[model samples]
Target chain A: MKMKCTISYDGHLFNGYQVQPGKRTVQAELEKALAILHKSEDKVPVISSGRTDSGVHAAGQVIHFDTPLSIPAERWPYALNALLPGDIAVKTAEHADDGFHARFSAIKKEYRYFVYTEKHPDVFKRHYAYHFSYRLNVQKMREASEHLIGTHDFTSFCSANTEVRDKVRTIYELDWTDTDDGLQMRIVGSGFLYNMVRIIAGTLLDVGTGKFSADDVKGMLDAKDREAAGRTAPGHGLYLWHVYYDN
Target chain B: MKMKCTISYDGHLFNGYQVQPGKRTVQAELEKALAILHKSEDKVPVISSGRTDSGVHAAGQVIHFDTPLSIPAERWPYALNALLPGDIAVKTAEHADDGFHARFSAIKKEYRYFVYTEKHPDVFKRHYAYHFSYRLNVQKMREASEHLIGTHDFTSFCSANTEVRDKVRTIYELDWTDTDDGLQMRIVGSGFLYNMVRIIAGTLLDVGTGKFSADDVKGMLDAKDREAAGRTAPGHGLYLWHVYYDN
Candidate 1:
């Protein structure tokens, strides 16, 4: 039987979401716990909707796995959560259609990047937000983000190491909001490339700090060169906020 | 010159707030940093308003120390913060009157205890809150807390090993509020005994879970015995919220 699970994790502990030998990773931990439940030495593979970089958190990451146990959907979370570490938790579990795939069937994803603009760092949120003491013009950042709100080739914003041939992706929304703590940027899209969200955040921050203008951002998009875009923001400030699928 | 400083710390890393031989403590760190500023091999003693146990955090802990440096009050934070670890930070610093004392001159203190009642723990707050899966009746807890207010001999709520001769203390406010994340208990008092707040939290938790009633709490208070109260809640869930003093 195929099961779909939604999970939330504090990503500070894991190396990343992908499985690697001898390294602690989210996928490895999930598989290890599942294997323990099955009482087998062999690895039990679990598929995630997407991979998040090291130190990046997730509030609604989706995963799918095949299990031989006859546990009910409601009990699956309880049964698995008991074996998983405190940093990772299975929020919900449900039966999925046989044809459903966690990654291929996803229609949209939302990512949020947090930046703390205060002069002094917040002790509690230190690990979760990028502490940049520079003053930011929220209006300029909003103006710059407007250019990013539609389907376009995002090669300039993607990491240089990405091997994917297609660079086009649809961005449904790109906006910023001032939270009580700091600035939060929300970006929703059909798909994202390697390091795309971080690069976008960094570029917008430059515009916010008066280093660049909205027109400069549009020129960078047209350049189609990774060097034309701003640096990639740190992964610790990023969060995989949500993932959506068409039923 | 004497300096008064307000500091906040993530106490998970320190053994406690006081100076103990061969232990990583907040006082030791502060004194060591001060010694470096003074260029002395001898330890520079710091006086804090009070000590916090291991894993207990603080947001507004006040302290006073005598220094030989002529650095401006505004620059003290910048200088000291550079030497302190990431977990500890000096929030503000200012010159204090000669008669001021961090411990003796303080008129009031506020402490907060956080309890996460959900079955699943919050990933972000796991380090700061106590995860209690049992259902809690807030009204019952509030009723029981009312008996604990006003001046009373808090011997039952204090740790047995406490050497302080006086067991009497005044609780100005003992109230609980429901937050978006969990239930938080705010306790304001003229002073607190060793482990008094934790014991009170545990007793209130008992009342919340139907293990004890408001009348039972009154009986325990009247009993004036350590064995009469509930267990001390874990130290990690407690926070020194603020310390008050007259200028």
Candidate 2:
């Protein structure tokens, strides 16, 4: 039977979401646990909605796999949690249709980024937020984000190493809000290229610092060059918040 | 010159607050940083408001030390923070009277505890909160807490290994509130014995679970026996929130 599961992870514990030679990863850990449960020598493959970079957390990452066990829906989380590490947890699990694919079937994705604007570092939240310490003009950042809210060629906002030839993507929503400590940004889009969110976040931060303007952002999009964008933000401050799909 | 400083730490990185031979402790780290700054072979002692056990965090732990270098008050924090580890930070620094002492000058202390009530563990907050899935009666816990307030012999709530002979202390206030992720507790008192706050939190949790009644808590205080109370809660969930003094 086909099984679907949603999981959350601290992200600091793994090298990244993909399997690598000798390095520990989220996929390797999940596959090991599943293989151990199956009592098989062959590796069990697990498909995820997408790959998150090193130190990039996930609140609602979905996956799908095949399992022969007849465990109830309520007991599925418990069964896997017993074997999983403390920094990872299976939030929910259920039987899924045989036709569904975790990555290809997803309609939209939401990501959140955190920036700490304090002059001094915070001991508790240091791991979760990037300490920028710059005087940011949030209003200017909001203006810059508005220019990139619709479908556009995001080549300037993606990593140069990306293999995806099509650079056009639709951004449904882009917003920034003040938190107790700093600023939080939530962006929803149909699909994202490699390092797309982080590059856009960095560009917005540059706009906040008056290094760029709203019109400059539109120019960068028009430039369609990766060098036109600012540096990529660190992965620790990013979170894959959720994924949307049509049933 | 006597220097008074306010600092915060992520306690999981240390063995405990006090300096111990061959153990990484908060006091040892502070003295090491100070001695390095002074470029002296002798250790510089740091007297804290009080000692916290291993894995217990601090938000506003005050300390006092004598320094020969006449650095300005505003620059003291930067100088010390540059030498301190990432898990610790100096929040503030100031010149202090020669007679002032961090331990004896402190008149009151506040503590906060966190309990995650969800049955499933939270991956992000695993290091900072205790997970207890049992159904809790918050009203009963509140009633039990009221009976514990005011001046009383806290022998039953203190650790059996405590060296302090006098266990009499006054609790000024106690409160519990719901947070987005879990339950939070705030407690203020004249002083606290070793493990006093954690033990009381554990006892209150027992009351929430119907293992003991509010009247039974009163009886436990009357008994004045260490074995009369519930087990001590883990140190990771407790934080030394603040210390108050008459300047």
The candidate that achieves the highest lDDT relative to the unseen native structure: 1
**Which pairs of residues collide in candidate 1?**
none
Docking quality of model 1: it rates as medium
What tens digits encode model 2's per-residue C-alpha lDDT throughout B133-169?
8998988999999999999999999989978999999
Fnat, model 1, is 0.42
TM-score per prediction, in order, is: 0.97, 0.97
RMSD of candidates 1 onward, in order: 1.4, 1.3
Candidates, DockQ: 0.66, 0.75
lDDT of 2 at B188: 97
lDDT of 2 by residue, A141-167 (tens): 999999999999999999999789999
Task: Give the Cα lDDT of each candidate.
Answer: 0.92, 0.91
| Fraction of native A-B contacts kept, per candidate | 0.42, 0.65
**Model 2, which residues run further than 4 Å from truth?**
none
Interface C-alpha root-mean-square deviation, candidates in order: 1.2, 1.1
Model 1, runs deviating above 4 Å: none
**Candidate number achieving the greatest DockQ relative to the actual structure:** 2
Candidate 1 residue-wise lDDT, B1-247, digit = tens: 9999999888888999998899999999999899998898987779999999999999999999998899999999889988888788898999999999999999999999999988766777778999888999999999999999999999999999989989999999999999888999999999999999999999999999999988899999999999999989998899999999987
Deviation (Å) of A238 in candidate 1: 1.0
